[model samples]
Target: MTFDLIIALATACVAFVLSKRSVAHFPLWRAVVTPLASIIGSGFLLLGPILNIGYGGYAPLIMIALCFVAFLFGGVIRFNMAAGEQAIQNGDYGALAIRIETLSSWALAFAYIISVSYYLNLLGAFALSLTPFNSDLDAKLLTTGVFFIIVFVGWSRGFKSLEKMEYVSVSLKLAIIAGLLIGLMAHFGHRALDDALIFNPPKLDGWSALTLAFGLLITVQGFETSRYLGSEYDAQTRIKSMRLAQWLSTAIYLVYILLISYVFRPDQMSSSETGIINMMQIVAPILPFLLVAAALASQFSAAVADTSGSGGLFAQLSRNRITERQAYLLLAVIGVALTWSANIYAIVNYASRGFAIYYGLQAALGAVIAARQNTGWQRVGFYGLLATLGAVIALFGQPVE
Candidate 1:
């Protein structure tokens, strides 16, 4: 009860602070991904699975690479905000978000399609974890439900519904995660740190390390969420939130990876979609129950939030004429279709490939624009190119078995 109270109060405080510093949709001190379930759903949960299978035990190396991914993400966010402002000043914000309208039209297609895939991943994982019914059946129902909800909410209430849901879900997720951390530390004691150090990775040299790290960069691409925050924040407020969110996300990533890597045996970690829950079980027998119950809320909130968000983005592409109801229907229809794949890893790998391609193009496009408009744009383009190359490696370099 005491711990729960502390968690609640702390989350409330963070939300309050974020709300105060917010402009447009950007909140001070809050990670933008927090608003949508995808941050943890896509990036955090997949970390263990991707590392265990793809990179083996060299996740720390990937995480180090992710730091740069984080920075590039920051720059992307800044660019969008700056671009939007520039457009607005020029009285051209009607298509400001579509700054490169034709190019962005394609970009939006790629992003929203990838987002649909991501939405299914979240919903599928949830069904795999909870309920006694068949995941296929459950997934279809959930997907359909999500689509209707998004359309209903989006048209009726607008993007604000997403921010509002984020306010609730993010607060809950942080509380639950903090509790998990405290539980792990309390039970394992400081000796767990020893586990992190025991796994010494083989040296691949600096250049090779960078190359391999670049391949893994796609895994950490979730932090630039602020870019979608146009009309939600002023430049000053957005920049502050952008930097803080990335650093905070990094900190969370480090603590979580260290926790899992140190506390559980390497072999015990399964590629089960709910692998995090499995890891918690090793920490304490009762943990799975606690975690499952907690994760239940986290998952549902996350699923609904993500489903709604993807719908919203698509609606934007349709020039709001597609209507929120239509977007929700679209999301549901897609999720039902994706639920056909029973294999989680295959779905995830494909989704990663898709997202990498999407971000790759966005960075490339952003870079081209920057080059013509700003000499510094070349660096952004190049960085994205390297990251895209790395993503290609993740797909092509390894057998992906």
Candidate 2:
């Protein structure tokens, strides 16, 4: 799992740097890159096991279909950045921010609060998973202390530091996961393959596949971070990075799902929070420990990236006059209020819904751009947006419920 993402992420970084081009417009590359940090955490761990088991047999076919959905997600990254820039060019950044808040509503704030808390839990899970070569309460307390320490450091560090931190943590998690998977495969050998090939396929047909696709949609839905990074890059670079990284991530995820499916019975996988770790346990119990370590790395990197990006966005929004320091202060107060009361499961579920809506909003922007013929690949983009909206609505349902 660690090394599994290396090839794709390393490629994304290269593409990110290379995509830079001179343009007098809003920066998007950073925003696009930052979204990756958000997606690679809890969602990645939970999404595959649950969606695959619930909707389809552990088959490569669904993985392939899911890749298309992720591609549409990438289009969303492009749409958000493009639209935000257009709003600025029209001298309406404040209006754009209003539109954003209007679209996201209270659910957006609630979802983020849940996300922050869950990430903290993930940080605790990471340390606990690694705690036994065995220690006791002191060790646990120390780990808890470390989690708070990371949050402070992440919030305080500037963008350069945050990006570097994410790259390192992301790299470490990928390495650890890759090693564990390889180690497990070697130990398990080929015996499981014959049984896996015997394949008790899913019985569902037609529209159910679409619903499954929607569920799978949650897994591979990062790649919007580059848009956040746009201020640091040129326009051509932003667009290219957004497009290439999304497609690349889709391809990588498809391969991962396929290989993992081939290795085990998808139905045998648990849907509990520890599902990914449990799936690895089936391969090798020790793999769970390694995954937990990776999970720690996952949350650390993602939180740093997300918080920093959000802060920058505020600065951008304020610089553009959408909100003031009071808005920022109020948001912080709201976050603290929601903190201790958050239920991990419900928050994560609500987060997925919020993400779907956010992505759906971006898709709407893509459709508008497509209709106007403003960018390369507009027609595909138009359809991509629709597919994403369909998936979001069809799979996760509405936040109002």
Question: Largest TM-score belongs to which candidate?
Answer: 1
TM-score of each: 0.74, 0.70
Per-prediction count of colliding residue pairs? 9, 34
CA lDDT, every model vs. true structure = 0.53, 0.54
Candidate 2 similarity to native, TM-score: 0.70
lDDT of 1: 0.53
**After superposing candidate 2, which stretches have Cα over 4 Å from the reference?**
1-35, 56-59, 79-88, 91-114, 129-151, 181-189, 192-198, 201-216, 265-268, 318-339, 372-401
Q: Model 1: which residue pairs collide?
A: 23-232, 23-233, 24-232, 24-233, 25-232, 147-328, 151-324, 151-325, 215-390
